[model samples]
Target: MSPDGMFLVTFSIKNTSKVVGREVAQVYISDLQSLLPRPVKELKGFVKVVLQGGETKSVKIDLNHEALSFYNDGQMSWVAEKGKFEILLAASSEDIRLKNKTESSSTITWTRL
Candidate 1:
């Protein structure tokens, strides 16, 4: 996902007939640890959602300016930042299966128009 602009992706998950457990959806913005010369901004927080078994639910991931901001030259690196970001929608953090994954990368940019 682009660093400067808002990115939104929605995907669905299928819940089988297994005994109902607390179904939660989480989104993570990663790749800040290995940025060249380090990244000025760091992504935080995970959006959690709940669902039920035998049900299909949609998870939306939104990337905002505040969540993708960094510092450069004593100023916030408002642009010219790029990296691979992973948008994960999972029932739980440890469970890799029964989840969806999306990835993208782009230079950071912002505008008021």
Candidate 2:
């Protein structure tokens, strides 16, 4: 980890189906709170990539302190709090494959060194 505790977000896309075609994968990284009843932040940009069928593509998202930090004890820490994080990796921004849902929703807890 860096002094700021920033890290890279890496993901892979695999063609599970046997069908062959040009697949374009659009990956997104956003805060979980935005999907809540009362959203605190706005949607960010897209991390786009194109891949072929049966091919696996890797994507990296640079996460800084501001992007991963949360208010803790009157200060922000380099910790992605224990809550569901929204990661959208799909064919399109609005179009998502139910069976191929790439977004992972889970709590991210980090240990401070």
Candidate 3:
């Protein structure tokens, strides 16, 4: 847990190609306070890793509170609601591989896996 509202995201990727493979990691935050989840932030190409054939690499991404702000249509401003939020890790928007939840009111709890 962090006192300044920041979380460390770490994941691993492997390249099974015969040559160097290029990959991009995307981090997205969604507000889960309503009936349907609302996309708050879409961070694409956040981590670009080039790996040789049959290689693997570990990546770390820093997520701050500012990156979780959502546009409040009723209030006509961007805000980070003090409720449930989900963080998604994906190679692309359509390929989310992992997801975890956090709350804005207190410390965030997450597993390494």
Give the candidate number with the greatest lDDT.
Answer: 3
For 1-113, candidate 1 gives per-residue lDDT tens digits of 44345667577766676655455555544444334454332334445545566777776666564444444544434543554444444444554333232333555544422
In terms of TM-score, how similar is model 1 to the real structure? 0.52
lDDT of 3 by residue, 1-113 (tens): 25567777788989998899998888887777743356554662378889999999999987776666655556566565567777788888888988887777743323221
Query: TM-scores, in order shown?
Result: 0.52, 0.40, 0.75
Better of 2 and 3 by lDDT: 3
The candidate, 1 or 2, that scores higher on TM-score is 1
lDDT, candidate 2, equals 0.47
Best-to-worst order by TM-score is 3, 1, 2
Task: Give the clashing pairs for model 3.
Answer: none
Off by over 4 Å in 3: 34-37, 73-77, 106-113
lDDT measured at residue 42 in model 1 versus the true structure, 0 to 100? 32
Better of 1 and 3 by TM-score: 3
Model 3: how far is 5 from its true place, Å? Answer: 1.1
**Local lDDT at 108 for model 2:** 43
**Tens digit per residue, CA lDDT, model 2, 1-113:** 34544545566667665565455555444555432242333233346555556677666666543443343433333344433345555566667532211222333434463
Q: Give the TM-score of candidate 2.
A: 0.40
